[model samples]
Target: MAKRRFGRVRQLSSGRWQARYAGPDNVDRPAPQTFDRKKDAETWLVQKEAEILAGDWLDPDAGKIVFLEYARSWIEERPNLRPRTVELYDYLFRLHLKPTFGARALADIKDAHVRRWRKDLLDNGVSAVTTAKAYRLLKAIFNTAVDDLLVRRNPCRIKGAGQEKSPERPVLTVAQVYALADAIEPRFRALVLLGTFGSLRWGELTGLRRRDVDLDAGTVRVERQLIRITGQGLVFTEPKSAAGKRTVVFPELIAQDLRAHIKDFAQDGDDGLIFVGPDDGPLWNSNFNRRFWGKALTDAGLAKIHFHDLRHTGNTLAANAGASIRELMDRMGHSSTRAAMIYQHGSHERQREVADRLDSLARGQLKSGSGTQRARKPKKAE
Candidate 1:
């Protein structure tokens, strides 16, 4: 029968105290269980008020949203995700997150559930890398759900679960690079050459146009990348970052090969496709690997080498050629910059100078024909 400062408490006919308060949503919320005494009811009201004042109070019913529905909406709402990124997220959700958490409400999901899901993925023979990707996607989705007030907190609290610990890729020697190039079909020889010497990504290679490559300048411009979506065959998209829209100077020594590639393989016109499949269609990674890359690796006598490793080898060659990290970032089209590097992109001339050094290094490595530098062991107890 008495009015409390925070909430009004009423003594029911059953001699129990019922406490009710107006929530931030302007709707009255009653305590789930009534208290036996006035003091207890008052204490409940005080705690609720404290939670509201501390900005830690959750809307009681907001988290009733289903995880699947919320996640779908989240993907739709994200404007900045690339098509390939959207495809990847969709794949992860379908394969990993959906079966376990899709039907559950946002509030019902907990950290324990997340841990169990991740463990199940690993137990079922999912690669650690794939599991980490799934965990990161789940964490990102829950993060947005929290911000949108759909959940009180993100349930992805496991430490380092989202971090990927993939094994280091093998880097090929200069001679091996040339061998792989020669072993591949003649048209694709330049593809492998540019992939290494120009440090171009697969998408960048597939997306190349006649105009993108400047043989006279000894440079290749990254205007866009060709990405393949599940339902969609191929789509050309602009670089995601300003850094990706860059000019990467390749060694002049490789220009003759490039010139021949363009004359023989590239489609007509300045805007014509530079590197097309035998059918003149944009190169599909799977098809290329099966039809060309796999056999080339066999012929070159290299094992466990990835196509992307070409770029890695180029990066290493550049570093060994005395290229600064900033220069590497510039050539690699890395959007994220290191603190010491400060995103200071080198001038075209500076890049060309680095390219020249790369040329010298490649020549030396080709002459030496060493795949790996073997470290000398010290004599024991001499």
Candidate 2:
């Protein structure tokens, strides 16, 4: 390989001091501007030389594609991405990002542009969390452009970049959970109960096959999830994370329900879905929610709650049962303990009980010591 070399200061025909350098391919390249003096030219040459040695130099003008064009190419290149992930990326790009930065050249984009866009989004009644997601999507796109040599750096790296904190989830009472479970139709009874006890995600619960459950062992193996993506209907995929692939041991009531479920409504084959449509195919999540979930809540006379809240209810119940943080984390298949902690915040009554127990134990110990001191008449005299 030819050793990179810096061009010496030379007076241009326009009476300006010019600096040049040999690129990696041994091609001579000139600076965009000529300096007023040899010192200035030498300073420019030194900076360029260092950048070239560090392998951080780019032509800047090369591949100056517009953000829209680069984004399309980026999406196209991700052939191995999950269908759901691709759908979300496409939606984010088209609905949120492209309208803002699509026309701008990748090289011309800067951190200030991103900051301004974020401010505009927040001003337009968009939640901080939404703005943060948009920012993340833009950052990912620009990072891809950088990787593909379409841009120098990601402009989304401005300080204080991230989504705002979401609202805290409300914990449902045990009475409310049981009431909802009771009001739901018999067909969906097991589903509601399982969600309230197992904390299984909607997809994971819907994706369960008969063979994945072992009623005798009182365990349900969660190995897959059913995802419905835009432009693609229903597809079964592995759990979102390794932690999502777990086995949850249900209580005896749940185990008995499973056994009965197998006997009464079980499909012909072991591979048949535990939850299916009237046609015995995979159930559509939207249909299930609209047809059954809403009526169940209304009948139960409870505030309208999301189907996913059952999972939260399960976590709360497990914590109230004195299950440790690690055990709750395992049951919920949470990738991080942080998320499990959010669900483990039990009711105020439970908190008070814990405090009372500790206080009573302390008082008992003090009383015992006091009795011991009184019994030691000689020691008291001393």
Tell me, by TM-score, which candidate is best. Answer: 2
For residue 230, what is the lDDT in candidate 2? 69
- What is the C-alpha lDDT profile of model 1 across 1-382, one tens digit per residue? 4545787788999999999999988899999799999899989999999999999988988899899999989888898888888988999999898999999999999989998999999999999999999999999999998888788789999999999888866777889999998899998999999999888889999999999998889999999999887888888998767788899999987899999999998999999999999998889999998898899889988895889999977877776666777788888888665521432344455578979989888778766866366345687995
- Looking at candidate 1, what is the lDDT of residue 124? 98
Off by over 4 Å in 1: 8-19, 32-41, 53-55, 338-382
Name the runs in model 2 displaced over 4 angstroms: 1-5, 8-22, 26-42, 76-80, 144-150, 370-382
Least accurate 10 contiguous residues by lDDT in model 1: 338-347
The Cα error of candidate 2 at residue 17, in Å, is 7.2
TM-scores, all models, native as reference: 0.83, 0.84
| Candidate achieving the largest lDDT | 1
lDDT of 2 by residue, 1-382 (tens): 4543566678988889988888776778888798889799989989988888998788756557888988888888876787777787888788778888899888888888888888888899888787787788788887877877767778897665675688765567868877887798776778888887888999998899899998888889999999897666888998877898999988886776667666766566888788776666787888988888899889999887788888888888888889988998899887889987875677888899999999887778777785343333355564
TM-score of 1: 0.83
